[model samples]
Target: MYRAIKYKIPVVTAWSAPGTALLVTLFPDISLNEAVAAYITSAVVIFFIGITGYFDKLLSWIPQEVAAGMMAGILLQFGLGLFTATDTMPYIVFGMLAVFLLAKRFSPRYAMVWVLIAGVVLSMLLGKINPVTADFSLAIPQFIAPEWTWSSTLNLALPLILVSLSGQFLPGMAIIKLSGYDMPAKPIISATSIASLAVACVGGITIVLASITAALCLGKDAHELKEKRYIAGVANGLFYILGGLFAGSIVMLFSLMPKELIAALAGLALLGAIATNISVAMGKESQRDAALITFLATASGMHFLGLSSVFWGICIGLVAHFLLSQKNRNAVPVTASDSKRV
Candidate 1:
């Protein structure tokens, strides 16, 4: 709503899961204060990157197949969690899975909604849902001073930028474009980056253009008329504001649900993204070897020299691509005329 009115674009923004995960991975055991500082630094850097319009150049530096492979590798665990949850709660897990598959086939947009309903009903019937003591008070935002650290700059900040750009913004912009919107990327990036910086002090991750939820609004289900689809975006933003006010209550509600249920929900939500990335990663014959190397390296969860597996995945994949391309270029084809001349 804000971005549309202010920048006159139809893009919507949300807190990025991948960006949050990078922060968690970087500062797993750190205090909240320290985490906020790291987030602030990342937001500042991303804000500058957006305003200067350098994101396109940075994105071009990385191969699309390689980036998709890395993203698939990163999201693999969540996809697996949907099945792994069955070990602990077979009935609920399978019930939700069935509902998701059926709904996905018949009415794809409402699959997650059906899955959530099935999970809740099955859990409640099976005595898995726990009672929560709810608080109706508004969430109090805390202010934390930004502290710049060399390690965070190198590790967390850099990865956050890459993942948010590649995993979130790229696909998000693609989704919008596919829906026939000629929305400019620079304004959207600048708006979200500024929003992220503004809210970082309140324990917020980077605000990014959403890919998954944005699809709901972009499709015919949102509105038959394409020009009027901005209403859905505005409605989403209004609900987000309302949800943010009761953030603590929402946290408590999720906390009351079984961990298995949460795991299943997340897995089902990411199924499409996982499938898409995997297809892209293995799609091209020439890029298959490099993409596979990247995927395996990233999914292995290995860390070296204080860097995450995602970094190593891209490095190894790029090296493979370069060498393979060089080999292809240097190989001489033998034809009838060439053989006769030889």
Candidate 2:
């Protein structure tokens, strides 16, 4: 709301799931303080990039297919969990899957909502919901002093910037443009970068322009008049503020749910994203080999030199692309006359 008012453009920000997942994966390798510092550093760097309007240029350096492949690789585990979870709680997982498929077919927009409701109901009936004894309380933001390290910057911050830009901001800006908005990318990126920095100490992830939710607001479903659609953004922000106030309760509630249930929910929720990324990664026949290499490397979970597989996946994929593309470029096309002569 502040940025929208200041810049006179419609902007809505949300916590990026991919960015958060990247940081969460780092916790096992780095200290919480280091992860915090790396995230803050990423936000600061992204802020400068936005202010200077260089994000587009930066994005141009990374191949979209390669980036998509890396993301697909990173998210493969969650997708697999949707099935692996069935091993323990077959009934619950299968029930949620059926509900998701039915809801998706009929009410595509509310599929996840239906899935959640089904999961909760099934869990409750099966005695899977854990008793929560924690008292409801307002979330107190804890400021952790960040400790920056070379590993954290290379492994966490760098991958975070790449994924957040490729996965969130690009799609979000495209949605805005598709919706007939004349919004510039600079202001939105700049605003969210600053917001991410502000909330980094409180364990907030990169706050980027909303992609999926942005589509909902930009559509006629939000409002009949396009100009009045900003009201939906405002309403969304207000709801987010309300949710933030009771973050503690939300956290406690999730913690009390069965881990298998949570895993199933996450897997189903991300199934679309995983499929989309994989399709994009392999869409270009020329880039198929490179994208596949990147995806496999990332999904393999290979780590070397204290860096995650994501970094290596990008490196290997780019190298493969360069070499393979160069080879194709150098290959001479045989002419029909030449073939007849031969």
Candidate 3:
């Protein structure tokens, strides 16, 4: 629901990039079945929130700056991974950067894709890719019957849903607003949740609104006419379907790719999103303190009482916001629209 870059790729609900590394880290022993089941549960819960219009009610209390702050806090570390990767894989990183810049110069929308292609090529050339056994076959969906328990539901399903809300959905809603689109929140939320639930039976772990990625397609950069830009969304859905049709082979390709290569591509893809989110989070004078608190708390990677840092960030940010604002009684309150200017 948050920010979108110009990739125009299908925004998969559950992707395995470093983006969901927190989930992976939280559930170290996460099996495909468990992952899928957790996603299914989370998706269904989110769908209820959407259909009941509870998500809109929830958004009212959360100012856009705080939402953006939480998002930036969660995502800021992603861009930094690119710099870290550069220190170890100099040629591959440099090659990817070169391709990113060149692609941006020509076809700005596909710059991230080119960076990914560059990573694959350079990694292969540098002898980083491991040889894999060949299997020429159509991708078949493996039905994973889920096993759910109180502990599993609490730890896995809840966290996945929270992350989907804080990590993906909130910022997604903000970005859509910032882009000046009058889109309704619940319908999109319901659609994604239903999709995630359906896909989970076939091993998809999560599906969320491509918030940041959707921004790429929403802007004038995607199309000269704002109204026509929705074509990008349609195209993205097609890409998602195509990817699902070939999920098994895609998973194999991803698994065979070096961790560094995947990390580099992920980091590169996130640079623009990170910058934009930071700008939005820090732009307001009234909300700056709250935003900063949220960002730092999230970046600290705090986990408490079995909850992730993202939830803590929002809680801490709101506390900071209320406390600081109370102390500055003379100062005019910041409006949600005002915070969204960035």
Candidate 4:
């Protein structure tokens, strides 16, 4: 639902069915029962956090460059994923890359779309594309009566709140900020959290702001007229709905092609956004080192205290920046005294 109505700014949940399977394998006792319960509790907590509107105050203290740096580091992998994909599907990747380059050279804005076309057509010709075999089913919403326990609330619910806020929401807002959008923290938070809570009853886990996918829709490549870009987001949301309705069929269809094909297409599509953020991150001379710290930490994918690298990246960069600032301030008095003696 979030992806379907993302342009309307509803936050939705995402999942990896394989990851869920692994969770079941690891802890047979933990099942969808706990997931729905924990998810609802987490959403309530997040919604409370949003209503406080404290994040806006926090944002004021965080320099824009640091945020940009973290985002650049976060997205750098997507830009580089194309090369990794080339190792497996060289022909498709090569063809996509060629079209991407040509389209970029000529049109710049529509290059990524052209590359998608090239890849899909080439895949079809190579007999790599397969027809959808799965039958359609109405995605009837299901409900699970939540079992609220101290352990589940603490272990699962708390972590869900933390990870979703630090991992998904923060970076998503950063993307909006870097794109010159004015999305206030409170409204976006309240809106997504409410959406999350509403869906939790149906055993749904999401409708959160999307960082990577949002970048694709919000970037300059989406349209020449900047104001018109929201339309792209609307379209993306509509597609998400369509895809969800026929998820089994669509998943099988996407699964037929090489995973690398999709990665390459997405990577090529995001190149412009990635490059723009990198430029913004490292633009200022004074902020350069701090920005580098943020970038390296984020790109390194370090996670601590149950949060993602993006959060730690900002913390580390700010610490380094404060240390450097203090050192410079302390040196100023000594330099003045030395000059007076001379």
What are the clash counts of all predictions, listed in order? 0, 0, 16, 7
TM-score, cand. 3: 0.79
Better of 1 and 2 by TM-score: 1
Candidate 1 local lDDT, 183-205, one digit each (tens): 76777888787788789888788
RMSD list, candidates in order: 4.2, 5.1, 6.6, 3.8
Candidate with the greatest lDDT versus the true structure: 2
Q: Which is the better candidate, 2 or 3, if ranked by lDDT?
A: 2
lDDT of 1: 0.77
The 10-residue segment of model 3 with minimum total lDDT is 1-10
Model 2 misses residue 151 by how many Å?
9.9
lDDT of each: 0.77, 0.78, 0.72, 0.73
Model 3, C-alpha of 167: deviation from truth (Å)? 2.7
Cα deviation in Å at residue 63, candidate 2? 3.3
Question: Which candidate number has the best TM-score?
Answer: 4
Q: Which ten residues in a row have the lowest lDDT in candidate 2?
A: 2-11
lDDT assessment of candidate 2: 0.78
Report the C-alpha lDDT of model 4 over 1-342, residue by residue, as the tens digit. Answer: 333244443232343222233234435565567777777887788788889987777676677788788888888887789989888788999899999889988988768778888898999898778856567675666677877777667766776676667666777777787787776777767777787778777776744667777777777777767667777776776787787677767777778877778989878888887888889888987788888999999888775765567778888988977887677778745587788999
Ranking by lDDT: 2, 1, 4, 3
Sort by TM-score, top down from the best: 4, 3, 1, 2
Q: Which segments of candidate 1 are over 4 A away from where they belong?
A: 1-35, 146-185, 209-236, 334-342
RMSD of 2: 5.1
Q: Total backbone clashes of model 3?
A: 16
Off by over 4 Å in 3: 1-41, 102-110, 130-136, 146-148, 215-225, 330-342
State in Å the error of residue 111, model 3: 3.3
